[model samples]
Target: MARPKLPISATILVKNAQDTLQECLDSLQEFDEIILLDNGSSDDTLTIAREFNAIYGNLVIHTSEFIGFGALKNLAVSYARNDWILSIDSDEVLESTTLVRLKELFGTLDSKDLDSKTSESSALDSKNPKTPQTPTPPPNTLYALPRKNLYNGEWIKACGWYPDFVTRVFHKDYTRFNDNIVHESIMLPKDARLVRLDSGLKHYAYDNITHLLQKLQTYSSLWAEQNTHKSASPLKAIVRGGWSFVRNYFFKKGFLYGYKGFVISVCNALGVFFKYMKLYEATLPKKPRSCSLIITTYNQKERLALVLDSVRELAVLPTEVLIADDGSTEDTKALVESYARDFPCKLGHIWHEDRGFRLSAIRNAAIREAKGEYIIIIDGDMILHPFFVADHLAFATPKVFLQGSRVIVDSHTSESMLQARSEENAYKRVFTLGGLKARRCKILSHLVYATSRVDSKFFAQKDFIKGIRGCNMSFFKADCEAINGFNESFIGWGREDSEFVARFLFNGGALRRLKFAGIAYHIYHPENTRDMLESNHQIYLETIHTKAKFCRYGLKDL
Candidate 1:
């Protein structure tokens, strides 16, 4: 049999998408041709696309009339020459795997499937001769692509941002966009067989707060205009405006999206509020819901006890305290158990075995067990500054995952730990006579391969606190689960936290270094993790440069 030709072309609808157009085009280079519809660009958008043609194998550009968003898209798609078409916006980029998969789907395109219709069975004709209408699937026609949107520079892994169902690739004859004035939904045939693509669209829709507000204003203005012309009443607009904010921000988990997401929800609310407020200035009223609190934790017995006491003493009690613990052998378990039994408010603890030092694993394990609608994670060793949890909860919304911070203990305390910890180079908790903090850097690295004895000062200065610590961090339960939880392979005391945070932020998880919002005090302890740190450090040195889908059993082998 002859190899099937890849029947795919990509179409992009653009209007001043200059700053982000090249990255978009680069992602779709595999397609046979690119039809760019520029409404009217004062920028180098067209010039850049033309320039890309030199490097990209095949590309075609078409300028469209600035009629409207949907009309412009429709006009652009009308010019595509290929049987199958892929559409993307200027702010999005395709993952490599997604591109390969799309091509594979194209090569196997079945023309006959798109043309087939369902046969009516004679047996059912007696009762209801008039057959019910069943929409046909978009055979070779429609591909439901995943769009991962990033707001305020953070990839929103949750809050309905990532894996958004967008109809990107399609057969030219069947798919067409509707001609709505604002916030228009896509129009497709009833029988469209939508195949979801594994690849994701990295969308930087709003780079910051200013951009987000601007877009909201445009959308709201357009919406009001459309509704005003549709015989909308003042009361209806008011109700819808209030409901929209409540629905998206509180009900849909927008609060979990962090500051950017919270802003988006607020903008969404404003869009609804303003649209109605403009439509019926005197009649409309908007009411916002109060915020909910969430908490996260792991193995610190004394510290956990302190947090529990502080929470009980709070003026405004949290909706709940979510204590997430990795398996703890010391009083940590007892602390959590006691909180669950004696605490006045709703208290819960998620417990897992003391596996290796997989912070992500522990975090994920705990998050799954969270009961609060919104969630926040904190370390056990740190003491919260009363309003710490309240501050994050205050900013809660479905679209936001608040990132909190931790300030180290007083200089004197740190100085004391530094001095006391620098006494031995290879300090192991098991061998160090019940101490929890170890002061041995040479015991773990090849730098001490020759010398069994370790210098405390050198070890403390070199290895004690270089990477990002998980002592203070918070996000939505839904968002964390969406990213498949944190990477579980970084099972060591060093660099793992930084590595996971980098992934979370890069994948569009918004962050806010709570700096002054949540203050925490680090407790003193004899080093308990010397052996595990040494082992994990060696693995980090060996494969630190390697970024794989699954980090090959870093410390699991031992």
Candidate 2:
């Protein structure tokens, strides 16, 4: 048997909410009516809404002109017969516990004569049963309830997402929402009172990185438009954006939530960054390209630390830094967490469960979370030169991927190289660690960068993919996406990078060999075994044979 409907009318303003509409409507089953003000939905949202209307027989669908959030909400509330309006977003669902509380409140405020006060005189003299007491009506105009925000279905307690109090239940006759384009709120009268209701609203903030980035882009545009009169510049955006990351990741204890927390913090900072950068573009000169440095690491925190320390001394810093951790233990996470506190830009740790060698997968995961248009990838063991990032950005052009060489250093030399030690001893310690040739072109490095300075001094290796190291690579994010990221089929470390570049070349991408600059110091470590080399080589050969443009399993799979 169905329960009787409450006297409250719930309202929602929806646009392409097909993913969350059904759950949102189902939550309002106890209300007398549900109003859906749909602007222009091209998806099956209307179909879903009509299906619910057929079953419940309490839903009212209204097609209205596209307007601001507040205006559309006010118009929806006007058609309701009840004075009380329960405002909810398409992504928000009512909690069962919260529904019971709403029902109890609805019962209390059900009287039509709201002005009449009930008599409650408990104190009666011994023989004064005939005495009359003053009457006072219950205060019930606006109600604020707590909301819990979820990201990727995880309860994100930090990032200002928990205990989020929103005034949803309100008397339409007393208050209406403000007519702002975005971030609209209910306008309460000077004497209006509020009742705090039990929390039962679950806000599905984001489903994934793509979902988060898309929402941030849209909302930031609206935010920048709303504040067009404010002054903003590139420098201001960087400072504010960095500060936002620090505040959310550290001050708000977002680090306690792990990778999801780090990504959310980064996205939050990106939200502020896009709003200001959008402002700069609308008002000031064009902004520079934002670069993200992604470092891939295993469990080598010592080498990773050296790499990060060298990164801090770069001449041109990247917009942000992300560590693609491949099944590293807690130590790596701790190192990243500690360094993130003082990092010049936002530092995020993207980790995956250790399942042998899945370099391509981890890199793809980190790339998806990057907020920069250009990405520079390096191994965690490679200590960078001060001008490394600047060198990459020098030749960073569309449809081009730059593969740089590294100067391999033995363990003894690596320890002393960055310590202002003897160059003779360092050069003596630089020995070949494996069968491959060590790139120890120290004299050439000095003479080439010193004497004959050629403009864009890099060869365009159009069809060549051999001898290209993945340790130092830079490419536009769009170009990588066009190839659908690295081939995840090559589970082992042998030919993943080569196969990636081969696909890039076959897909009409230009490759360049960065020389004389963008140098990296590779810390000597025993080379990974060739256990899976034969299998990976077969995969690489197939890619070249077919001239594969995209991989079946890559970024989109994540």
Candidate 3:
């Protein structure tokens, strides 16, 4: 007589998985039954499933709206026809060797041994009446297999991607998937004998970088929604992002894959950052308002002209322009007035006497005179991208001040840009001779913007704060007023911005770092005098020591 077929069923949950579903089904031809639970798929996924069922007699297909991975997988398990169920995703393909091993393992299980195990499991379940009794497996049969994930046409052997052991093969009676919306795993009975098969499964996770980013966006949003009840700050997100990169790249030996490894590691960090950022945003109130661009200036009239020209090219213009003049020459005033005629929005200047390094004072004067509900502050020497204003507005949330970053243009590029003085030309040269960091920023701007983490931990780090320049920062007018604005007591340029940020945090305002979106090109110039560095540092220290949210010598004092 012919031997009875091994009682094994392969199950998968799918949604728009046309690309890999065929390969996955083909790989499981040896199984007694194939159970497919598909979420709503507008693509050719259902057609392919039907074709496979026609070709293979044991194929079973079910359609449902996705509830959660855990719940959906359990539903798939319930539809499985055989005693042993091998759970897999639509994107995964089991190896031929793994199939052989699974068959061999299942074939060895004696029916008498299974009956004894089931009796013992029932007795244990009776002893603990509070615990729900699941199906019991045979005496010695539970299986796990390593999964090799593919990304960007490459097998990522490191960065915590390899040897991804999943407990997929289990007796239908003894195990079920945990109820997690994402990253769901199988839950095994305490008494089930677990075994890891030498053969593995191939997981085609992402087709390319774009695919990875799309998933990152979707997954992060879902994670944030799920975690809305949990408390998360921007600082915690930053720390988690940074630590994720380090752990995956160095400790996980992701460096073995070269550039691809680095990219993967960075993407991993970004996932963490975006999740927390969304979570932080959920806590804030939403109120739309107009914005005023506050440009601080001293000298550099030529560069200031280019700055205004760039502002004119903005996709979304500020409601008004406030030039916070710190005792500049008549030439600077003339430049501002000249642009006022052609500038897209209302333009005005807040001029003060030529007192040395009185940026804090001039900014306060401008803030008091400003009419817009929001303020985007940048130095006159810093030229902005067309999307700068729009990006800030897109990410704007109440009770949060945005601290943005800039790409440093070397002195040569600065001169080149000054001579051209065109917004288009300035943006074109942002990648060339603008320095290594600038090129990197230009290439990965979107990723950087998506994952920029601003948390208290990053704020507290001195070296990290250096990247958080006032050259590109935005805040709500009300929030600025609450903190009494920039501390005019800060004599020089050094710690004025840092002190202000510290106070903002102390007042329960969260800081968000804008990486690529609110980018500015900082024109290189001679270093400012740091003679007041010691005094400024002392004042900043005092702010921290006293836990002072409002400075006595701020905008109001001025």
Candidate 4:
């Protein structure tokens, strides 16, 4: 005979969870209903879930974009049929014995006085049989249960894995999860009775080392974003990281679990270390940061004067401004020297010997000389929007490089603007005379400038490196150092920027398109000589194919 179903509904937030959703749902068969809340899953997870529903007829599926882990969990709970909610992850399953224990706690299965009937009975006596039914839980009560975490199908008892207690069973009216980007928790209500259960939940969390590291990277970034503060620094990372290893491996007995335990302890320490390090990187660019705005230019002194005039109009000035001169004449040097007298910030010119187009080498030289933890790189021909520096500062992220939009001034308009008598007149020409052709001019989101900034993934992909503009991109100084800056081997103009970005992606960094913000206007000029494009492109392809994380000659040599 089938037992009466427990008066509980399971709620889960799923995203590409096909591999573990089936077993997770299978363990909740005896519940009254199960709700799967999907957040933009691109896998076969829905198909597998629907198939499970066809047989069990108790699953409720709902979909929504992810807001955050805490809110998403509460949103899933709202769709459930019962107030008695069982919160579970797609990677966890309720153990069989634990399920029975859970049922007994709700008073559904009555424990008979078998101690008196065992001596002479047929076990299933004809007279006084027990009746099984679902029971109601006490009001204002929440349940916390122990969980067993497994890696490679083996239980990990150390490294803070064993007897991990989590509050999963709760009443909808009394408690909900706190809204946090990472490490969210259920809020304990006033005077609420917290019941800790001995029931175990099996979390088939991770075994594949690669996937585990990926999760660690993501979680650490989120944690860093959520914990940003003015005082975040490198010391916190180093101290906490060292403490985690010692505490877990020695004190917590993680070393006794053999190599697996040792790996877990090391990974835990790394997770904490990166969480703090990313925070330090992200927090540095919060104010009028010590940012170096690198303007790459050559012999175009007249055009360079207009660009510098636009720089004078920046809403938020950089800490130091540098002209990365690629073998320009003495006239360009004099022009920059004139501006440095009373420029808005400390302005200087960094020049190397004029060689055949050595944009990559000059950029590397400028990077070495710059003293900012955050760097914004642009070409000298581009006229800046008033909010360009402010927008770039606001859009700064820890491990992600931002590529931004630029508007174009046609050749005739560009000539007229360059001929203006005063810097103010040239600045006025920026908005009045600019036009846009994103693809032809190598730009995107050109006409969408506003006071607000919006990041667009429309062009962001893991392997995407095309349409990148070195003229309007921002990255952390640390990240630039990680990829060893640009590949200086590209002697002439071509895919230098794209090759730099490709190496960044390979170095576990991401690309985010800065749209509706950080605007620049490109003055029309004859295209640079593409004589070395084919060779440069070959270098780019090699970087991608070899998964190269750094260039041998760029920042490394510097």
Question: What's the best-to-worst order under TM-score?
Answer: 4, 3, 2, 1
Q: Which stretches of candidate 2 lie over 4 Å from their true place?
A: 108-140, 284-558
Candidate 2 accuracy as TM-score:
0.46
The alpha-carbon lDDT assigned to residue 410 of candidate 1 equals: 49
Instruction: Show the lowest summed lDDT stretch of 10 residues, model 3.
Output: 119-128
Best by TM-score: 4
Which wins on lDDT, candidate 1 or candidate 4?
4
Number of clashes in every candidate structure? Answer: 37, 0, 5, 0
Question: CA lDDT of 401 in candidate 2?
Answer: 70
Looking at model 1, residue 214 earns an lDDT score of 84
10 residues in a row with least lDDT, candidate 2: 452-461
Structure candidate 4, residue pairs in collision: none
| Candidate 2 steric clashes | 0
lDDT of 1 at 439: 25
